[model samples]
Each structure stands twice: as C-alpha cells, then as structure tokens.
Target: MSVQIRNLQSEDVLTYSLPLLLGDVRPPLAESKISVCNRRNNTSMSWPVYNGTFKALVELKPGENIIELMFYGEVVELVLVYKVPPLTRFVRPVYIKCHDDPHGDFQGPEDEDCSAESACQRIALGAKLIQTLTAEKLAEHGFGRKTFLLETDLDAKAPACHVFTSSLSVACAQQMTGAELWLKFACELMSAKTFTQKENCKWFCFMSFTRYEAENDSLPKSHIDVLKQTKGYAALGGGGLALFSTGNLHCWAETLDQVPLRFTDTRKIDRSKFMDDSAYRGFYWANYSTGLGSSLHELGHTFDLAHTRTGIMARGFDDLYRVFIVRPLRSRASSCSRDSSRLTTPSPYSSRSRSRVASGNSIGAEPCFLRPLPTRLHSQPSFPDVIHIEVGFAQLPTKLTQCYTVHHYDGSETQTVVTRQSDGTETRSQLTLSPDGEWERKDVKINQLDAGKTGMQVTACRELPMAPSALPHSAVDGPDSVQEFVLQGQTPSDAGAHWHRSSAVILNYHKWFNEDCEKNQGSSPEITGGYITSPCGLRLIELRNHDNGTVVHHWEFLHDDPPTEFKVNLDKVKDVLPADCVECSVMVEDSRGNISKKKVHFDDL
Candidate 1:
C-alpha cells in the first residue's frame, strides 16, 4: 500500500461508535481513492484520501470484525473488536408538538419531508451520529471509547425518539424567549415520574411547529434580508436537558446510509431548497456539520462539561464534518460563520462567566444555551533517566461510578458516588455500567430492575448489605434538585499530563466584524479573541494565518499558581496577517505538553 494508516493498529478493541473508520493516510498518496469492504457484514465504504488524511463512519458487527481497505493497487487487512457501551444513563431524543399540531409536522422546504415519522428517523440518525462522534473522540483522547448511550425503541428496534404533545400553543411558544422553551421542556419531562426519579437521564428535545417569521423590508421596493429573519424560540441546555429548534431538521440525513454522500454534498442552501434564516448554512452538507456539532455542544452541558477556551463549547463546531470527513468537498469554510453552536457567553472558561445560566447563550439567530471529566493511576518518580514499560489489557474509561445516594428499605443508605481529586477540585468517580447492558437513569418510565439487570457496573461506590442501626435516620429522602447529578468528571489515567478533556474541543473562535464596513472587518478594534482556562497552567497560545502559515499573534504564560483563566485578544493581528488572508488557526498548549489546534476562516480583523 502506498498510503499507510496513521491512527490505527492492525488489531484493536473499540467499545463504542461501531462500524467506524477513522485514520490518516501517508502523504503523496493522499488524494488517491480507497475502497473499504467489511467482509463479515458485507458492507462497502469508499472515501478519497483527503490531504494525507481519511476518516469515515463505517458499518461493522459485534465480536471479531474483519475489514479490508484497498488503495493504489494495494490492500490492507485489519481486525477489531466491538464492545457495546454499557451506559445506563442515556439522552432520550424526543419530538414535541403543540396541541393543535399532534402529528408533529415541522416546517421545511417542499423537497424535504417534515412529517413526524420522518422526524423520528432523522432524530435517531442524528443521535447515533453523535454517539459515534463522542466515542471516537473519547478514544482519540485516550479515554478508551467511553460515551453515553441513547434510548432504544423495543418495537421499532431503533433509537427511541417518541413524539410528545406539549400543552403550549404555537403562537405562545413563538412569542416566548429561548429560556421559556427550555424551562417548558424540563418541567414537562420532569412531570413524568420516571424522569424525575432517575437523576442520571437527560433529554434532547425539539418542537414540531416552529416557523420562520418573515420580516418585512423597510426600504422601498427592496426585498427582505434572508439572514435577518428569525424562527421559533428554542436553544437551551443544562441540568439533564438539551432543547433546540427544528429549523435545520430538513438538512439532516435520515439514515447512516445517507451520511457519506451528505458529507460531500455542497449544494447551495437557497431558499428554494432550505428553510433557514442564517446564511451560515452555506451549503446542504454544512447543515449536518453545524447542526450535529452544535447539538454536541448543547449535549455537553447535560454531561456537566463546561464551556472551554476552544472547541465545541465555544463557536467551533462548524467544521464538525472534519471529524467524520477529513475535509470539505468544496471550500466554503471561509464563507461560513460561527453561529453553528450559538454560544454567546465570553468563552474559554471565563472565570467571571455566570455559573448557573438557564437558557445559556445564542449566536446570530442560532443560540447555544448551557449547562455546564475524569483520575491518577500511580505516581512516577521525577528522575530524568528512569523508563517504565508495562503492557496489559486496557480498562474502560471513567464511568460515573456513583453520583447520588440511594436509600434502601432497611435503615441503611448507599451513596452511589466515589469521590476523587481532579486538579485540586474534588470530583465523582462514576460507574464505568452493567455487563448485561442495563445502565443508569430512570428516565425511561418503563420497567425497573436491579444494578445487575439494568447494567450498573458496581465499582467501589456501591455499599450493599450495610448493617442496620437502631438510631434515627439522618439521610435526606431526596436531593435538592436534579442538577445535583451534574457532576464534574475525573481525568483519565493516561491523561496525567493533560486536562480532563472530552472530544478534544471542536476548535472554537469568535469573529469580530466591523460594523462600519463589513468588507473591512480586518481593521476592527478587536480582530478576534476567545476565552482560555486550564488547570495545568498555559505554556503557549499562537494565532496564525492558516492560508500562508504566518504567525499573527503569540503569547506565553509562565507561572506557578497561574490564574484559572483569562481572555485572549488578537487586536493587533492585522499588523502581521496578510490583508488578503481568508482564515487563521489557533493553537494552545498546556504546561503538560498537550496541544489543541483549530483553524478559522477570515482575514484582517
């Protein structure tokens, strides 16, 4: 084979994100075509090498799987193991409708199907895609492919995304703010005994009847600006809930079969084909990247992940396609905007940022609301000449070992969480889930079972058969709120020199446009800037013109007890960046040698 696989070994074990093919190709043979065939499942996937890289979501079966990839007249065989994720807590995908529109039909371009059934399929596909991305990212971070699972429908044998009829009216909801929409869903879902009882469950919800409000143009004989028009109110996440608008559902692929083509699809998002207000959806494929990536950002909040200095938590999910596809089919990246995640807060773990914001924030008309990981194995002597080598079976990544307390029938209590230290902050060591596949969360509202039946992998946290005491009970019957389940995760063992990171952030940035002259945004007061926060302290932060690879701004922080986090401003980048530059990339490195790099399009400011 002229091209070698850079990210994977011959035989590997994968816990989640089944049927996935993610790796890089050796250069020179970069753009050549590669054909991937799964012998056991009789499945075929093909993607052209992209700039010395290749990534795709493929198909596979349980247990031992054989895959053959051929390129440049050479074939490479690979073997891997697929272990289903044993996560008990899951994010339930749901489609809600107003009483008047029970079918839950969403507004969209005529060419697209917006019916309830179609919506369910799209939702299921999107949820699975998210699951795959999460697992792949966790693996990339050396976390061993741990991720949350999605509820499954027994009858359909698919993702269990049910249709919910909300009591609110279309008119009432449209007039309500984003905060109202989120609260409604949280409260309504909580009304179910199952959801309220189980603190582990989270929800991903969308409404069916949010229509675009066409704004009238004031200029005589002038047409309305397509970008100015806004849609129904919805965009919030936190405390076991993630709610969003269905404006971009039309752009989502209905099944995994449609993703490969959808990744490379570049059809212009004209009003004739798309039901949207933000021009950021530059093309059809972008609809998938922005929607899915942004969804990951909102969902991150439900998992207790905070807004970081960069990546999905910020404004960088627009390139989510890069995670699935090495690069875009056509270069429309610069034409796109940061509205994909709709995060409006001053990002980069702002030390002063609000702690408990409910609705979160927004980008353009697209708002990304909030919210809000993982441990040390052993200590190594700081000697300069010592080397250690130990090989053994890899353990699964950190699970929510235990997060809350469970009161038994007798005078005994079981505190389900194991506490640990994470960068000076105390955190919970979670259940790493059940072997039989029943995991956490009572959100299903269906059946009940024990830890073994439900798949709750008992770690050190489960305190069973506690001796009964005659003294009066001292434990509280319940928690103050479901938010108590929102825990700060532990750092992975291998992540010793790195922070507790999830999904290696999506590469985020905030573009500052000059109001006086949109074309002259380069001269804006603040060229571009974002938030930065790290526990290990910062080593360096660099901003460069991606087109020419010229350094535009650079900073180095050297201190013992460094401030938690601070803002990053590139106000002087125009002095060094080429006037014609289209995009730039930001690279941040922590004191522990871990680095994060992401590219953004735009020049001048």
Candidate 2:
C-alpha cells in the first residue's frame, strides 16, 4: 500500500490521490478504493475506486496547511504524519521508592547479623496487612482504581523510619503539623525488638534539645510545636527521634515515668530492667506505637482513616508495656496448632466499621429471625402467572355456625371453608377468635382452592333438643370475623416422553385421617383429587403447607429440557389436601437446566 499527498490553493480544490493495491495484481485497476484519515483526532473516511488510484478533494483554509497520505486495504494500514503538534504530553501513575542515602544508615557492618530473617518477616507481614485492609475498604466503598506502592527507606543517622505519603498534599500537611515525625515515632515503637535484637545488640540513638531565637521571632514553646503549629516557637528538640523497632528498650525500673531515658552504664543493665519500662515519650505512630492492634491500626491512619470509638482501629491507650510487664501476666508458649490450621485453610474474617455492629448469642437467648432459602418451582423459561383469592365475612354473628366461600380473581366459587360440626366432628373446635374492643376477629383456613369460584353466603340458624334430659336451643350464625388466602401455580412441558401422558401426586392429611377414623368408623372421607393428561411424565419435588390448617390445591411443576413432549391437564389432576394451613411451598426438579417451585396460600381453604 502507498499514500499520496497534494497541496491546494484558495478558490481551488486539489484532489489528493493514493493507490489501492491488494494481492498480486499485474497493473491493477486504474482507480482503486482507499480511505482518508485525520491523524489529529483519529477519524477516517472510506470510498471505493474502480481504477488504480482514489482521490479526495481538499480546500485549504489559511496559515500553514498540511496534508497527509494514508492507506487502508485488505492487506495493511499505512500512515504518514504530515502535521504535528508543537508540544506533546503524557501522564503516568506515580511510584515512590527509596532514593539515594549518602550515609549507610540502614546498611550493616561486614559481620553484622542482627537477625535479618525475623526482621524481614515482620516487615513483610506488615506490608501484606496494609494491602489487605486497603483492598477490602476499596471494594466496599467503590473507590477509584489506582495502584499504591509502599516503599521502605531506613534512616542511618537517627535510627528513625517513617511511612511517608509520597503525595505532595500529604507532605504539605505533614510539614504544617509535624505529623510525619510523630508517625516515625509510632512506627519505630511498634516495630519492637525481636528475639534476636534482645539477645545480641544494644540498639540505641541520641536525642538533643537546642534553644534558638529567630532574630526577633518567638521562641518554640515545646518540642511538639516543630511538628505542630502552636502559639509560640521557643525551642527545637532533636536527637535520635527513634525507638527500638524489634525489641524492648532497657531502662531503670525505678524511673519508668521519665520522658527521655538514658542508661548510666549500658553493660550494667539486663533484660529484666528493659522489660519493665513503661516509658513512652510522644504520640508517635498513632495506634502502631501503642501496640494495641496489629499493623492494621497504623495502616488505617495511612489510608486517611480516623480513630473511631468502636472499630478495629478504635482509639485506645497502647498499654502494652503495662499489660505485659507491670502486671506480669503469665506467658504461654506460642503454639503452631492454631497458626498451622489457619495457614492451611483460610476463611473470611469480618470486621465492622464505625456504625455497623455484629450480634452474638449469649445464655438464654435466641436468634432474632430465620430466613429459609427460596425454592424453585418451574423449569420453563418464564415464571407461571399467579392468581390470589381471599374469603371473608362482612360482619360477625352472635353465634358461630356459618360458612364462608372463597372466590378467585375471575369472580368464581373456588372453595368453601365452614365452621360447623359434621358427622359428630366439631370443626368449630379448631376455630379461634380474638376480641378487639367491640369487634370479634376470627381467621380461618380453606383448603383445595380452584381457579374460578362463585361467592359464598352464610345463613343464620338455630338447633336445639329440649327434653327432660336433652340439650337446650342454640342459635347459629357467622363467626365474628374471617379472612382467607389462596395460591395457584403451573408448569410448561414439551411433547414426547410418554405415549399417554399421565402425572399424579398423592395428598395425605394426618389430622383428617384421625378425625375421620374416630368419627366415621375408620373410613376416610373422599376429598377433591385428580390428574391431568400430560404428554410426558411429571415430577413432584416439594410440598408446602401451614400447620393445623386445611391444605390448598396449589402445586409446583418440574420442567424438562427441550420441554417434555406431553399434553397434561393441570386442573383435572389438582387435589385439596387435609389440614388448616396458611401457606405451603413445593419444589420440583425435572430433566432440565432449571428447577420449578410453587407456593400456595391456604388462607382461603
């Protein structure tokens, strides 16, 4: 492919032409097709050519005019820069790392071996903890995605190390408040001496204070003023602004309250004296210096997280020294049992923020609530349409011997729930009523509900047996109050599993069985039950029903892959179950990619 360039003058259109070549054409067509491209904004235009070359006309405006030749064919793309911007610019993510240090502050002497292995492990653990916390917070809060680098640079002169925010904004804030110095203090204290440090070296630094007057300037009031902006500048305090990063500091037990401790004779002191020191000079590294939490506390502050009263990084005094030594708590040997298990099978740990809280169970307590998983009913691509029905009475009656009927959405008689005694069985005994002020509330269940049903009416009546030793007259009427509910669901199928499609599910109500046996000579009463002719076999998965209530005639269907080939009558096979139930659910599984579920409300039963 090749490109061509052309120049045009005012009042004239110059046609820039380029050749469109593809494959191995011997003397290709005179004018071929090509595309024109604008390098400035990465836009392009394409056109077909009949000959070896294609042309685009350009009318130049003013100033320094530039034109470029470009080619785009089946074979390749070609571009020639004919214009350029005066200045080019680009931006990239910033990374901070240890720069140059003229003095070997961090480097060890030729034979120096201060337990490097343990120190490195602690450092690595600290870094990983920081990264983990930051990642978790970012995920929960939806923060912008950007990589942050944690670089460690050791200071040789002062034995001081700090976690500096490379961002200028952070640096400026530090300079204005001396926060960086405090941060260094906190981190050094937190990185207490390891076993190796305690066994081998006397790691120490020197601190000095100087009073300087800035000509006619105010004197520094305290050492904190250098790190913090205060009313006056009286003095500048300096020295080894450092703390033991690996082990405990050795100080006289008698003067644990001293600000800056100095060993009169370093060789005369022993480990016991160091272990008993409770001295802390400054608000060094926030929680890190205090040793109240792991590295997470310090890391939280680095991420701009503030102290909270009840969080993982809650602001609490770092009484580690007092907790460990002054109190002289028992020291148990560390165990690998818990650590090994954790390392092998890690599980998610939950930590709450300021406002969120977690609840736990104590003695004589139960869970607030329970949530069961939702069951599937249909395997079809879509959900089954739902139709609900309710049965109720307009008013209450003096006596309770009336029946209420349930109605479907289509205004048809769906089911009947009665409050009466039949066959020497007192169904009214199962009915409950609650009195609210002057009104009586009675809620009952109706079973075996259908899609379409007519409205039901309750009539008042009086039954009595008056004799020398018989019952007295009694009036019958509707209950004081009533309410009902119903549920309906269906499944879709494909044709071809069974030559004659037939599906059936048995309904058994233990309460009805016992009631009928005791009242009717052990003969079970016939309830509504049947099957629909489906093209293929159907599967019944689960059954749902309320306790102590009549069962509703609602069910779930299992869908087969490619839909089972069958024609089934869902209504003909439906049946009402025994028992007074508010709601029942069923889950069905078919030879398909999904599961089917159905839930029916028995309030209308």
Candidate 3:
C-alpha cells in the first residue's frame, strides 16, 4: 500500500487540509493506522480513514512544521512551513446598558446620575488602554490590536441592547450564571447579524453595564461549558468577548475558544490609583482609576498571553503604563521550544502500534529535549515545591472557630482548625498534611485571632527521603519507559436489572509502580530529572466500550494535579448495547508522563 498528500503547497499559510490516500491496501488493514506528527510542536493527530481516504485540519505554527505521515508500516515525511503575516486590525462595536438598579427607578444614559458623557469617558479610557497594551507591540509579531467602538443611543427611550435586571446581592447575581447571560446576549447579536461575514474580522467584542453588585467574583463553570460548546459561534466564526460592569472590587477574564470574555467591576475603580509608572509593581493595581488595567489584562489572555513575572501579563493590575512600555513581546521560538519538550508522549497501551512505526523509518526518530522531573511533590504538583493560600477576616459572636482546608496538587485535600475562646485564649489544631509537604488554610474568622483581627501564622518542614533509584548514565528510554497496568473492573451493586438503568461502573486500579524498579526513582535521567515527581501525578483516565469501539467516558487533567481513582458514569453513553457487552478498555497516565492501558469484560466490572 502507498500514501499520498494533497492540497499542500510550499508557500506559507495559516491552515490547510492534510489529506491522505491509501491504494492497494489489503484486508488486515483493520490494523492499519494513519498518524500526522508535527515536528515543530512535537504534537500529533491520528486520522481516521473512510473509503481509502483520510483528511484532517492542520493549523500551522509561525515557522516550519515537519509533519510525518505514517500509514500501516510505511512513513512519508514533508515540511509545511509558515511565515508570519502582516498585522491585521479589527474594530468591534460595544453596547452598554444597565439591567437593574438597587434603589427604585432605572435610569438611562441621559439621566443626570448616568450621563452619556460619563459612559463615553469610561469607554474611551478602555480603548486607550487596549491600544497602549497591544498596538505596536503585537504588530511586530504578526498579530493586530482589537479596538472597541461604543455604540450608544442616548435619545432613544430604550438602550441598543436590553440589560437584563439582576439583584444587587452577590448570591442573587451569581445564581444567574455568566455563561447563560453571555449566551443570551450572543444569541441576540447573532439574530441581529451584529457580526459581519468578513473572514478577516472573526473577533467581536461586546461591552455592557449591569447594576448587580460583585466582589472578587469568578465566572461559574457553566461559562466554561458554554465556551466549550459554542466555541466558534455564527458569522464571527470565532467566539466573542463580553465585559460587564458590576460593582465588583476586582475584575477577571477567561477564554472561550481562545476568545476572551472579561468582566470589570466599575465600582472598584479609584482614579487616584492610576500611576504613570506603576506597571513595574509585582502586584496588580485592582483599584486603577479608569479600571483599564484589568481590561487590558483580560484582553491579553485572548491572545494566548499568560501572566509573566514583570509585564502587563503579570499578576496585579497595577503599573499598566510601565508594563506596556517596558515588557517586550514574548519570543515565539523560546515558547515553542519549551512546549516541544513536553509534547504528549505516546501511550504504551494505545491501539496504534508505535513499535513498528518507530522502527520502520528514520525520518523523525530523534528525541526532543525533556526536562528533569521533580524529586519531591509539593502543593502545586506541577511545581517542584510551592504552596498557595488565602487569608481573610471573619466575625463570630461567642466562641470563634477557624477551619483550614489544604489542597494538594494531586487532587487530595486535608483540613485543620483553630479556635478562640470568648476570654481571648486561642487553641491550635494540628493539620493533616500531605506526603508532599503542602497544606491550605480555610474558613478563617476575623474575631478568632488573639488580637481579634486577622493575624495567624504557622510553619513546619520535613526532610525529604533520598531518591528511590539512581539515575541512568546512558540515553533514556523514550515514551515507552514504563509498562502497562492490568485494570480490573466490577459492576456496581446499585446497577439495576435493566441495562438503561445502570448509570455507572466501579473501577479499581493498582500496581502503579513496577515490582522490579525502585519505587522512589525514575528509570532514566530524563524521567528522574524531569519536572515531574517520583509518584507521577495521575494525568488521564478513559473508558471505552469494546462492542463498537465507542468511548463511553473520558477525563483528562493537564498541569493540575490528577486524581488517583475515578468513578465512571455511563449515562452519557448513547449507544444501545446488550447486557453482555463485554469488551471494554481503560487507559491511564501518571505524573511521570507515562501512559498505560488495560482491558476487561462487563462481567469483570
């Protein structure tokens, strides 16, 4: 059998379709597989074949991408190079309206208390902030600045967009999920055709004001789910951005399909806090007079920029002027190089045979650089050693009690508490610490402290044990360093007699460490010295029914700590199957970046 590539030229491009054709492919081809490996990012995608043809969307990096096509036992390699294009600018219209008023009558922009001039000042300030943060800096990297135009109708009885009413109470406003509200607004815009059909203008930004009170509010999980579901909505083709004004003390933002939807609390703004050279501060200035700092930060996330140590992307909304002038655009080459090291390693239990593919061709066999894993786990499993906590005040009338809930990076939690008597005496409780030497404090009371204020401190440390095994001196074993584990399953006692009634299956996994290998140390220097700890964090768990090769449930945790055990729910599986659907498989991965697989029958689980 032979493979061919189509719809590809030597010129630079943004995205393209990678099509492969299989000719004279024989029967046992059921075992045949097709994979596309991106050498630049060290990422790969498996293409499913239909009618001897396979096609997949290939988004290219800024530079060259050495993509390898492997079908059956043959491997064909080619280079798809991309060059940075000229910066493209986009201007999205903004709409503002107040949904609710805590006092009595609602006021439009024309009202003396809510004048159009005042709204214009805030909108213009936000625009200046965006231009200062992006404009020239991003233009150098082939990315353009996104500006907003406030479209206001002050003379009209009703605003351009109706702002739904919400109560001022935090609980009342929070009960209405931001995603639902954002979706409602987006659907209205979609129906209005607010987004043009221009391909280049894919991003739309919408700004609105609400009378709801907010304090350090975070978007609900429903927002993330909405973004995941309606990632690329309507004519815009890309998700949109929304900035809502609530009387919140702080502002935050999140991405929906890389589109940033940010919320700013206008009540928290203190114009006095705006400093011309304040961007150099380590903490964000949440009290900026114009409330533009947080707005810029949220917009940065839309560009995939992360928090840095000393830039606009850094924590703390303070020092905007300095951040824009001092911080340089992140180097693409360095970021890509770093990501290439942690590219998803092949799983040993994956059905696609890597052994044959690895030996069949010498095209892309070289191993990329791998960072050393951590020796000891910490509060942040991804970090070698670090702890994060929040401290605040609470009041109690009689005996004051404070509870601490410590969370480990590995998805485990422990709790501790302290109490103060009415007579001013304090009692401390020992904390249940994780083996990784990390703990968190929770439910603190302001009146419980010895001084009747928020003042408390605790310190503890332990010597970590030596490495379990010595590091190897030679070349490390690539992705196949560890062997697969045997997965055993059992039917839940709660499973009803009817097949449809059974919603979940119990899964038990053990034998994580190899019997012959040292428990504390990794097998190779690459594994031992990598950013991961000895008992690698659990990365992924997937359950698939064997009858028709359909996946029933899948869970993946990246960067954050992974769960050691999983309870798989089968209610989402739509396929109708017989009671004897026996062939089922489970896949798992550990913090050490190794994947394993196991198979079991329905009777076994």
lDDT by residue (tens digit), candidate 1, 46-104: 66565666765666566777888877677878887765544344568888888777677
Q: What is the alpha-carbon lDDT of model 1 when measured against the actual structure?
A: 0.52
Winning model by lDDT = 1
* Model 1 CA lDDT for position 556: 42
Candidate 2 lDDT over residue span 1-605, tens digit each: 44433222222221111111122212445434445444444444443333343333221222223334444444333332221112111111111111231111111112122122323323333332233233222222222111122221111121112222222232232233234433443344335452112221111221111111222343222322221322111111112121122222111111111101111111121111111111222211211223223233443333222232222333222322211111111224422122222222211111121111112111111111222334566754885677876779576433336555432222233233345333322232222221222323344543223212422211000000000111111121112111111111111111110000001111111111011222322222111122111222222222334342112222223222212222222332233333344455443322211233345443322
Poorly placed runs, candidate 3 (over 4 Å) = 1-89, 98-113, 136-175, 194-199, 202-207, 212-238, 246-286, 304-317, 323-605
User: Model-by-model lDDT, in order?
Assistant: 0.52, 0.24, 0.34
Which run of 10 residues does model 1 get worst, by summed lDDT?
A: 506-515
Error of 2 at 301 (Å): 3.4
> Which ten residues in a row are the worst by lDDT in model 3?
497-506
Clash tally, candidates in order: 35, 70, 27
List all candidate RMSDs to the true structure.
27.0, 36.3, 26.2
lDDT of 2: 0.24
At residue 138, give the lDDT of candidate 2.
Answer: 29
The TM-score of candidate 1 is 0.52
Models sorted by TM-score, best on top? 1, 3, 2
